[model samples]
Target: MSTLYTETHIGSMQLKNRFIRSATWENMATEDGHMTEKLYAIYKELAQGEVGLIITGYANIVAEEKPNAGMMGMYDDSFIEEYKQLTELVHRNGAQIAMQLAYGGTKTTYNVGERVIFAPSEVCERGTKTLGKAMTIAEIDYIVQAFAKASLRAKQSGFDGVEIHGAHSYLINQFLSPYYNQRDDQYGGSLENRLRFLVEIYTETRKLVGDDYPILVKLTACDFFEGGLTFAETRVICKKLAAIGVDAIIISGNIHGKANDMIGESFEGHTIQPQGYFHQYGDVISREVNIPVITVGGLTDIDAIETIAANTNIQYFALSRPLLSEPDLVKRWQNGDRAQALCETCSKCRTKRGNFCIVNKQRKATIAGF
Candidate 1:
């Protein structure tokens, strides 16, 4: 068996393999953020496919602050019973699952102008062009408590871990981004101040979930924008997070005004970047931190994955679009069919009903024509 198939630990959570299904919005939840059968099937497929760890689509920690429609909610206890079923289902399939908690800041148009969108500073988001209200001290405390409560709910509902969504210019990431966070308060200004929000969230959540439970962070290694969070500063942040007892860090980056790092153009209206586009960022952070480091973004090739794993300190690899196109990709590779994933990075996965791979649909249609 390849090393990628071997067991490993992220904190106390044991993963069956090195491949993690990075959180991708399935957009299948009910309007009120309840789990639906469609959402259950999505997890069932991924867990049954033999991935090591599955990080769910980011769940809304604030009930009225869902920036995306059909998002899973953890704002209250109403989610506990249904999520228990979700966690149990994944466990039965021999996989561990983590629930990613997020509060979308200005990266939204979901309910723009209808409600307040909080941020570290009142800035116009480059990506969404939505202006966010500067979060008050009271509001900041409220969100910290919300994350803590949601993490407890995750533990009670049987999640193996909880990942703080601190990437993609979301609420937490906004606080980390210098371009977005222009406040002079204790929660903003210097890098240390900018980091206070996440630290508090982790501290509060740790108190509730205890020191033994895994608390992972999906961190923006760099903002990839002018006057934004830099990789040099991010290294410092990673070291601090490791020092603070975060079980693992998943390295990702955000490009202001852009959604992803895909380059070139494809016939399907989206292009794929070179495999492991974020590996450079993760490689450095892995060396900087003692805990496990996972890299997510444009990773699809098995040989490349193996080479990177062998050469770098990055402990894990995560995939999103590739798995959307081939849920059984990990199993396929392990079964000796190591062909790279078929996902073209078409960017057509999002739909009104849910996220479905357009390539898969076309392939099925072609087969039906025969």
Candidate 2:
């Protein structure tokens, strides 16, 4: 009988409510790949208001790939101390934090000039467009080790949990999507092989983290792009992850670059997007496994959330844009405030330069009830 405001547990971390701030890239990190004061302030604000859990923007596990396009990286040993500062800040304000670890696959980015892109396979026009050299088995093993090592670091950093980023056409997603993964040496070819990377990542991560620490995965039921991972394959992965003892699965869909295929859109849509916009996928996967299922997309309305909660099938909801515009949106909205924070979905938050503060002249300025 859980509702939006009810306290819940996903493995080790206890949440005040079911809401989580999904990972939204806000190029607010230190240039040297460490958490910055700007990033700390954002989480403190998110916690000061009403967020239950905060999943940070994608953290790079492979520094060579520049995983977050200059946002943040978790692959280094020194990052733990900076992350601890962030955890302490968020917790001091009363919010649990999780790190969403990511690795760029074919979309290897360059900070200023050109760079190399790696993937499970090298099939088509992507990355630098010159067809990346397909990764050997040895290279894939190295990636698994890297993910596991980073997870250990995240735990050491005082994070409540770590989420493997297996969605949105990143490295893990690339392996899942046949359009990019074309390897034949037992790392690609069949669906099982396609999932091997994620499975192995979870395996190695579980070995490092054990069952005490919460291990969640951010995955997509379908990539929603041409020749991308399908719902069929996604369901299989969900069940496998559940069988392997994953605490929860945060379901997301396709890359924002393909706006048309996107199930929904939001500039700050990473963490605060509503729950169950992808309920169809959650519905499919939840039916297949026992793990908690959380869905996120453009869930901007409060009334709609009430309806979602009434369903016994849903576990929780994640709201994105609303929290960005106003961190205390939950407190105000539930307290009978008709005028709510307005996030225009302007895509202002995604600019490589930095996230724009778009709440000044717009939101009608309701007093945040501390």
Candidate 3:
């Protein structure tokens, strides 16, 4: 039997398989962050396509934190009913779904126009000259409360769990990375202080969601940049998060200018560019903690996945770009296809045009012309 098709558990959430549809920025939501028919169709397709667990794109925890147009929202109770419909739709199609909660911090605010961005310290954001003002203690408290409220909203929306988007230079990441955080206060300086923000969010969210609900975190194991978060720091952070009751940890890396490196570039078919790229760091973190570790990035081959599964403690494989090109990738592999994903990693999904597979679209157009 294929290990990828076997059942697994992330806390109390039972998944039919180990293939997780990692959060991808589906520019399908409305400007107000409400779900549209387009967004619903995408989730329904993934569920029907047999994605074991579908984690929705980052949902803003507050209005000011809205990063870009068409992003999902879960900041208030008003969003609960609409998302309930989404979760119910995915469930009907036989898949578990989770909502990723995030705050853009200094890295984003383009959608909200010129506004004072929040950060751990007043410094120019990397890759851009934009200055981030240090948030006051009151503002920090508000953000922590916002995360808790968002988690509660996710549970009320019938989501299986909530994944805190602590990676990718978001609010939580800025506070965790020494490259951005420079405060000498309780929220920064020491490693424990740098981790205080995320710990607080998890602690408060757990209090609201109770013990049975699975609370996951997507973390950066290495920033891959000078003066940024190191693997050593991330290992400690992962252990702390696991100790604090985080059900699982999704390991990912690179930030800001280095973000493209994490996604990787196009390659020849079946070559599997940098296959299992982040597995080593993930393995280290996994061994340091007792919680399940989900490894993502440059994973496209079934054989490679099986090898990694057999060799490491990683319990789940998360895919983003490959799924965009082929939502039924896991199902196809399980049916004995075993071929590598057809996605060339063109990254049209990351472009402003919208999140979609240009490769598939071009192929369809070419076939239609014939």
By TM-score, the best candidate is 1
lDDT tens digits, residue span 1-370, model 3: 5577878899999999999999998877888799887788788888987899999999999886677778999888889899999999999999999999998876764743476678898776665455677989999989999999999999999999999999978779889989889999999998899999999999999999999999999997766667888777888899888888999999986543333354453211111126766777787777788889998887889898989889888889999989888887888887878899988765766756567776676422211111
Higher-lDDT candidate of 1 and 2: 1
How should the candidates be ordered by TM-score, best one leading?
A: 1, 3, 2
Model 2 bad stretches (over 4 Å):
108-113, 124-131, 257-276, 338-341, 357-370
Against the true structure, what is each candidate's TM-score?
0.94, 0.88, 0.92
lDDT of 2 by residue, 26-59 (tens): 7777766787666777788788777889888888
Instruction: For candidate 1, write residues 1-370 as lDDT tens digits.
Output: 3589999999999898999999988888899999987788879888988999999999999887999999999999989999999999999999999999999989998989998889888898887899989999999999999999999999999999999999988999889888999998898889999999999999999999998999999888677657988877888888999999999999876743233444442212223237776677788789888999998887779999998899889899999989888888999999999898898766777777677787676433211111
TM-score of 1: 0.94
Give the range of the ten consecutive residues with the poorest summed lDDT in model 3. 264-273
RMSD, one per candidate, in order: 4.3, 4.7, 4.3
lDDT of each: 0.86, 0.74, 0.83
The TM-score of predicted model 3 comes to 0.92
What lDDT would candidate 3 get against the real structure? 0.83
True lDDT of residue 247, candidate 3: 99
Go through the candidates in order and give the clash count of each.
Answer: 0, 6, 0
